[model samples]
Target chain A: MRRNRVLAAVAAGLLLTGALTACSATGEGGPVTVKLLQFQEARADVVKDLIPEFEKAMAKKGRPVKVDLVTDILTDDQFRTKITQQFYSGTAPDVVDMGGSNVTGMAGAGYLLKLDTYLRTWDGWDEYYPSVKKGARQRDGSYYSVPHEASVQSLFYRKDVLQRLGIDTAQPRTWNELIARLKKVRAKTGEAPLVIPAGTAWGGGSWTEGLLPIVAGTGSTLYDEKSGKWKLRSKGLSATFDLYADLVEADLLPVRDLHNPNPWEPTKYEKFPQGTLPVAAQGSWGWKYDWGPEGAAPIKNSREKIGTWDYPALVPGTEPAPISGGGFGYSVNADAAHPDAAVELAKWLSSGKALARQLTAVGAVSPRAGLADTAPYSNEPSLLQAEGKLKSSIQPPLGDGEDRVSQAVQSATAKILAGEADGSQAADAFAEEAEQLLGSTRVAE
Target chain B: MTTVKNPAARPTRRRRERAALPLLLGPSVLLIAVFVIAPAAYGVYLGLTNTQLTGFAARDPQFVGLENFRNLLGSADFLESLGRTGEFVLWSAIIGQTVLGMLAALLLRQKWLRGKGLFGALMLLPMVVPEVVASLTWASVLSSESDGTFNRLLGLFGSGAAAPLQEYPMASVILINVWRGIAFAMIMFQAALEDVPDELIEASRMDGASALQVFRHITLPLIRGPVFLYLLLTTITTVGVFGLVYFLTQGGPGQDTEITSIYIFQSAFKYSQIGLGSAASVILLILLTILGMTYARLAKVEV
Candidate 1:
């Protein structure tokens, strides 16, 4: 009896394993399913809108390919963490949606399928702006990700609030001038003047949106492409830290609320719309997706009330050192079973109508120069304005461990803003931590 | 003599019993080997490699012996995380849960207490609520908003809304964990308290012993085993805590609350340094093992 039971149990286990294996294998039936994993919250709706179009395109092409999109609504840091976990377990989706620095890092490390060969014959690849395409290409000039949306970031302010308070709303040419303006706005309104994403929960936004402009304004930045080194302790980096410290010391930045899980929500979506916060660094999408009529606040008078300005230089005389990045880039997994189908799906995702839908939904500045003439692109004034600035904006080169660098910078910036560490001390600590996090050989200076 | 003669002949009763036992347990043994042992073994192997989430190394990982372990030992973040984790366990499990749970159990044991069933249910309520809900509920209560429950309570005393989570992150995490975990200790202590003979307490009272004296001398000694058991369980569970703290703080206001679990998670998944993460996990495994062994020795039982 016991022997019989053991035999039955063994058979059951075998059957279960076999069933699971069969289910996991690339199916041999009707339509090939391409899994898309994405963390862009705004595109969740856009993807839903595009599924029918994708099906129709496939049917027209007679490929019978099915798109299965898996959207993770977690914040960027959280979703990327989960994506890495999936990569380790060999269960990652066929296509992934990532941003400039992160997608570049993933591509550099060979997680993404090289798309140069695939794109050489594709017609629309050349229409992308050179800087935009730079993000999708590796060190060896192999194209991995297909760059779609170009992100244009700058300071967003309430024009009506500034005018009401008798303050000048002109774009400041330098960091000192911006501070002077903020001091005036604060003294006049007696409210929090600027909101820099500060806490660790804000992730790289703390460094990228708030600190990088200051660094660039000083004529140096984090990633030095020539040596492939992270310049952790530079004059520019220290200056950036000082700028953040100044904000905290002046009580200009909302440090407390920035520690919340959705730090941007209160500062950008709620306070910015209500005119409580005068200025915040925002992408073009910040208006439409986060604070416009389609956003959480839905402030009706947003178009008239809001204004955008270029992030200023560190000194008064130099031009505004603007920074733009790949807002969303799509890539295929190297390990995906249906790589060809995944490639087809990626192409479809970046094509005219589907890409237009995404660009409209996200209100992102389009990288494809031709999209500027598209109907949907023409409709968004904010996007059009941002696209005009993309030519002059700086697209910083990314390194291998950009995520860790971002986290390390974010942690140090957070400590400074929270008053846990002084500026010089925080910079020193950040340099050390980042060097360790990125591994020493990755850092040159 | 029959057992010795049964080598090639019919099996003896003891032999049959042993053979039947192995056959009966074979399936479960196989399941455990496949599920638990295989992953554990794989984890150890991963710890020895230079495998990352991306790169050529990810495709073909090369073993680096003890490099990851050395790196972990030398890492300030990992060491700091270890220290913070120790503090969290000490406060949340050893002191907070055990002491508070014991007090609740003592209160509930009073014969004249009203609505014992309702009180019992209330005590068990936090244990039943989902972890995400519990953490979020605490977040709302402790927020910096002036209308938040904690701040509102302090308003009558002329105090402003001070976000305890932002100001006293570690304390807030410890308090919430205690709130969530006291149920286990309470229920266990209640059972232990019930097992304490009432006749001895009554006799002690008749001898002019006060309630406190009886609890300290007789009541406490009887429940010593349960106390150790509770500490042991809470220690292990508290050390492995992830989800609640992850949601509440994500290991920051600035790494102030970065416990070992969070650190390991960040190293492996967030940094995509899977080998380093796996090494840290192995260290964590050993640390927990040592803790478990120490607890077993203290409890004088196989734990």
Candidate 2:
């Protein structure tokens, strides 16, 4: 009986130990495990290849951390939902890959670890473009995330199609000139010459991908940083809407295609390659991820066939600047057990060959200054060209009330696309809605 | 007389039994309280607050009692979605699925019908297909491309790319949902019809009653229990349908097909207005409850 009791006790103790071990993320005497969560399929393979290298580098830096990365792919939508829930539930991943838009809100909600102290000591901090570093800074002058790759918005046009139509391939000096060019294309071919993603279906794209570059080129900011107010109605905003109205009224834009569930499919993938759409405002990703040999719809000799142009100014006197935003960036969760290691890993992912490989795979320009002279970045001419556009690029201040502003843009542009409202009317309605959401004090005309 | 010596013992035993009642029912009551009641209560609380999925409001939400609901009621989009949801449920669930399923079931019950097993299998195919797969199949069929299944069929008659989804989003969604939901109703009605006595129909037929009269007077009344049950189930399920409409048209083409559920999803996940979405959900819950109660009362079914 004594022997049997002892055996039962031993079994029970062993079972309890196993349960506790299973529950713990890092076991006793085991290396601290840092979890990395991400959702970019274009960079998934590259990221996976870089993880072992990251682990080795960290070991050399005196942190013997075991990186726990889940290879299960998630769509962007899934990532947003999962990350939000995880943060609220206090089970957030140690390090995360997210869009630039999410940084401000996440930082404000206290979900992200403030990275200013770490960044100050890091050598690569000076290598990142000034615009990128400034965009990542919160209103409180704290950094919460580091931009991994930069997606500069540019005018993606078909070179062969433009040449055939006898249209100048040079960048138009102003919005009016660009509009005239679009009209010429439509008059010659009778096909919608441009696609600027609009409608509520396009979601945030209506703001960032479609409107921001034009707004920036107009020399008026949507959300003024100095006044800390959303420019609900301004000359620049009206000009942006007027341009949209012109495209819609003249039938120079694919209005129907913009309302499709996935507008990018019909506009960028199918129509552009088929020559039905000649010009579109797209991120630098259009070079490879949207039109490359390995893209969903590859155009033969895409690099040779496609050309890039900066968004033009509203008036001739001012120089035009393209828009740039963080394509994908890394952040350390505030609740991480291995925050130091996580921060190191994030820094490792942002600079050197790792960032180059990731950016090249996704057709994005590196925010880091010298990466353009390196092997992988130099091999790709698209990246080299896009690098030059980065310095002249403007990243609109996005943090507080960004979601509401995006919605307002989508709602206004959607009305423009449907022909329900003209530019002035839509601007009025947009102003009203933004004022209601952000309050009168926070909105400006 | 025989139990007179221990009469107090019987009362004690009865008291013990009464005390043990809670112990026996504790697990079930606790489960329901945790799973159903707690979440619902939290939803109600969340509805009264200005809780957002992101930004400062996410961490420290302020109470804005009835504001979310007031905004929802005032918004044209929400009101339109309610109307569209009503039309969708009426056409797809109440009328389309019920009638077609009954017809299919009646035909399969016919002795003269050949290949009854094959026909039933074919009808069951949509039900067996995964929701996402079925949605993809329908998407392909109704694609705007000239080579799409429906477009190709239209092309045979010299029609251009109809783009039926963009032109007729509600009708297309209703049609697809009707197709997907028919099998469940058919199965239910088939089982109910099996319990329906053939002798009564034969008697009625001999008494100069036509097939239609017999069905109207006998079969329908006999299967009234299952009919109401199916209606209650189908109505609730149809109102909650998300994947079919979402994957196909995501409440698009300018909110033409934005049903109540889709609106709630957009308000919550898309717009990140958790409070507004929760308020909408609370209203939806109350409406569904009233609907279920009305159905139960009309059917005179036991609770």
Candidate 3:
């Protein structure tokens, strides 16, 4: 009888929870309901605010949407598993959140609905930057996702510390100059000069922030546009690895602490602000989301202590190029019941009020123009710098083999850094790994 | 109790028994067939194809018999993962847990420790704690940084914060698993000891046999069943452990702790190479089956 009572209570609780979550849809007069599943659970608040705003907008249009929006948050692996299961089971939500390359892969696999028609028809379509818009277009010239926010990675340093040591705060013009600055910083600070995200956990980052900037500076990109293959064995790629090799030989990058899942915790939060480390590759989000007041380890006087340099150029006598094109955006599931309504909802959610709300909540740089007057972003002046850098980006492809390419680059770089192989050999290994994973696809020279 | 023998009724009774068989065992048999047997068969099929989570293969998989297996054979990552898994099982299950737990159970049987139920309960704290929590706790303990508890303790001894996981990644993970698993092993051993014939031990002592001699000749032979049972359970469990080791190390510092299970999981999920993962799992399954059968044969236990 007690066991039965306990089970009854559990059943009652589940029913209550379901009822509360279903009022807009399953209630007596629920409207055309649309479901949105967000993987980055942290920013669910933005969408929570958007749902009501969307309803209000639709109500004003005399076609009120009593859309039951479910914001399910999950870790990366859980999201991958759950979303894939949903996809295979035909239970995926009408709308879902995905990253840049994730959007490409999802769209390419026919899992996501294309947004080209909606984007072209949307009034606010012209507001987004051309580069930002271009980044969303898959190889078939279709918009798979609506670009929401973007980030630019560069070498973050301590201006005060560099000034104290009488080193130039001016941006590095070449790889050698950057290395010289790091060596000088090491001699003066008596701490490790740099921290590269090289561990297995920092899979994509190991290549994106660590190696790609150098590759980009030397006029190399991951995707071979003309041939539509990854350029893993290029001279610039090997040179990028060699630069890391140089850092490894000098014991510049902190090999020990780099093994941590969040190398940024030590490098950005503790070491950089504490003046123990003077230089590291950092994304724009690191300013506010990482070490600012909103961060896990908020540094006092973060602005005064930290500074950004154009990530050092590969060749001497050239300005460093910023690597861009990574952010969260919404994609409508291809198998959505309300595909048109979902696309319309997605269009509304990706711009104006909703997107701004999200950008503010995540403290991300707005990929589109005309959002400079927002509260949190307006309050932080450094975001303006980040905003300016977004246009000057070297965009990578967002599709199949993109993730594998990242892993291959990361593994190769790790081997080179650990002295298991030289840059050229690591280059060869990278080629082999990439080709093996992406069969019949040759690495572009 | 039979009053009359009816040959005609006997065939009818046999028919009734046969009819009842299907009704009695149908649900469980059906469930096992669908969930277990079908999935295993499907996994073997997946191994023979180029199925993946992404790309063209995800949409249109092509069958290539033994290709994935052939690739896995030459792959250093696969071999290394299997080798590391073997090392982890040998250390954590075969040696560490069995020896420590047996010794602990033996020591706790003393009359001087009578009525110390709380002490015995305290020993089980690690086992009862959730796997993620235990792994996280040890992550803090094994951390080389200043915030690490183990390093903090070592600071009093005038030693700096040192990276245990960095220097000994696999051993650290194995030791953490062993520590958590030892409680269960202890409980099993303790229960097994109750079935040990006390009279035989008393007679051995009376005969002036040394304690070691008594344990070797009498105690071991008596509890051989439980010992084999413990080995089988631990080995099977340790071979499949993914969460604790994953939480603690995430199969890295460059594949140092990427056990076979973790490798297969990463391939299928993280890397999106489902066909390769399926192939790898098939190999792992065969290896485990062989090991299990070997142990069962040794124990003379029908499995």
Candidate 4:
């Protein structure tokens, strides 16, 4: 019995060891582990396909590279925890997908590799939009990352609902016409005329993007470049907050209950398709993923019923302003074992050719200008409409203090909507918070 | 004549046994020092510096003395998180363990209980389930949407789709923690209750003592040690409630459910404030140590 027990123990130990070994093994290789971590939910399936391609390409060059993909569907808060833990332990992934705001802080910490040398040599670098290129580079002009994809926020409206309400299907160019039409639609259909996701970090951040054009169009600087101070108390900002507050008060948005947490991503698309929510202010990325093939399949022949338009200006005096949205570039880990290989992969990932391939594989818009005019995307009118909005898009201001400013804006808006604060109070509170967080700081550049 | 000879000259035997004790305990002591004591000491050291995880070479971390601790003490967010953690531990550990454990002990002592063995096994189910799995399951059941199982069940009783986490953040987390932790308390209490002398209870009954009186005077005193130990264990476990908060709410509906552990996680990982995160952790450790020492005193008294 004792001998049998000993044999059983040995067998169990061996089996456990073998199982652990098998789990960590990424095929037969010289054992190069590239940890790829991302926060976005929509990118998972595309990454699942892309990793094997990357591995195969590396293998062809006699490099036994294994991509250890660690996909996390994290909220803004959770993503912070994950990035910090990895950075502190010096065990961060070889490739990290981070928000644009997070990049500066990480770069400051010397966690990200400088990629100016690679960027200078890389072909197709000029194809990217100038703003996107600027956004990817560190303030010191040391390029740290490259733009992966670009997204632009647009007004998504149900053409059928607009027609039913006797509102024009043609896009509204100014806030006055848009609000009038929204009120008319609300009166006619008894459904929410607009759906804004207010509570979610991404959702709230989207509002900042949407409002930037209005702020910029007003010829008011939202952030003082020299002082690195946020101008939330500016008239333009106050007007924007007031406009949003008015929309909520006018019964045009979902009730406070519906705006509970992170705005329900799929629900907004579903409601818009179902004609329950007549309009949604969201990113162009939502059109494909949230409304297209992978998204909730709206009714058959519902293509004509959906239309994209630039977010109308805050007033008739201003031009249509839309915040341009785009994916941030991949940063090579400064401490990566194979920095050259990592840089090479990053370069390929950001190149026009690689981006085009990715755009095709996953229905994402390339950050490269004119890429959307080709093939599959060009055939889709909604995508074409989104691409059109991207032409006049203004990039949101980037600073080390943007996250705190963004949160203050969201909190103030929430309070205003909750009837606890007025528009001016909200604006004042936001400015106060921003000043405390950013007033003493200088812009990195 | 005055000098007493050692019995059989057993110095070698004593030496052999003395050497064996050190050999047996050496590895365990080494492991504790390395894994536990070293990290804790390092945490204190790290907390005093303004370190960022990323570029250690570019920006040298400055020793900030007690500035990090002072900042944390003044931070409303940190204070709010500490309060939430305290509430969670108090209700989930103290109230949860006491009631469920006592009920379980009483049930186990019943004579006519059907499938007693099966029921006992079932009671231990939650303790055996992985913490992540339990958290995920509870998250699913209490999800914000109408598709959640709890919502579906509530619909039958005419309660509309209400997100438990959003509506009652602390209560919802406490309920889940209690459900997951009751098994440990129940099993411990059951074992303790079993060791109670039947003869003592019989004597109390012969003196015309009521069931309640016998339980209060006899059974309760016998199981006091286990009860105190269970409380200490539960308190320590509840102080670090991370998985449930992370999996379910992510400390949200606007930081309503933010606990100390979640805040520390966010500071360290999200904000990349390694020093600040470590400071928060040390503060948490201090709070836990005080609670532990208090419990230790209580446990000694019971013994």
What's every prediction's RMSD, in angstroms? 6.1, 4.1, 6.6, 8.0
Candidate-wise lDDT, in order: 0.81, 0.84, 0.77, 0.70
Candidates' chain B TM-scores in the order shown: 0.92, 0.93, 0.94, 0.91
Scored against the true structure, residue A304 in model 3 reaches a CA lDDT of: 88
| lDDT of candidate 2 at residue B302, scale 0 to 100 | 71
The regions of model 3 sitting more than 4 angstroms off are: A1-30, A39-42, A66-82, A315-319, A353-357, A372-380, A416-419, A442-445, B1-25, B109-112
- Model 3 TM-score (B-chain only): 0.94
Tens-digit lDDT string for candidate 4 (A1-445) = 9999999999999999998788667334464777777676656556666778777888888985677777888775567556766765698888886656567667866788888887788776877777677666655557677667767766778888778768887767777788888898888877667865554333335344445544555556676645544566666788877776788778887643443555554347456777878788766666566666666443445477777777677744667766676555688788987777777666666554455555544445667776665555456565555556666677766555555465556556655655656667767766764443332343221
TM-score of chain A of 2: 0.91
lDDT of candidate 1 over B1-303, digit per residue (tens): 354554645457778888899799999999999999899899999999887875433566779899889888997778989999999999998999888899889989998999989988998999999999998898889877788899999998999778898789999999999999898899999999999998999999999999999999999988887788888889889999998898788887778899999988887887787888899999998998898888878877665
Docking class of 1: acceptable
Q: Write the residue-wise lDDT of candidate 1 on A208-321 in tens digits.
A: 676665566677657776676788888777877888888888878887778766788778877888898889887777767777677766777778888888878764355775
- The candidate scoring highest on lDDT is 2
Tens-digit per-residue lDDT, B245-285, candidate 3? 99888887667788999899888877777898999999998
Chain A superposition TM-score, candidate 1:
0.90
Question: How would you class the docking of model 4?
Answer: acceptable
Q: Write the per-residue lDDT of candidate 3 for residues A1-445, one digit (tens) a residue.
A: 9999999999999999889888745434545667887766556766776788888887788665656666666655457656765765678888887767566556656788878888888877898887788777776778877777887777888788788988888877777888888888878766777876774656666766666656766775667655767766766777777777788787788876677755666777778777788777877777766776767567678788888887667754556777773777778888877777687777787776676667766657788888787655566677777888788777644545666777677778767655787767778888887777776553554
Off by over 4 Å in 2: A1-31, A315-319, A432-445, B1-25, B152-162, B194-200, B203-209, B217-225
Off by over 4 Å in 4: A1-102, A166-193, A200-224, A227-262, A296-303, A313-318, A336-354, A360-364, A370-373, A401-445, B1-4, B7-25, B53-59, B157-160, B206-208, B299-303
In candidate 1, residue B208 scores what lDDT? 97
Top-scoring candidate (DockQ): 2
Give model 4 RMSD, 1 decimal.
Answer: 8.0
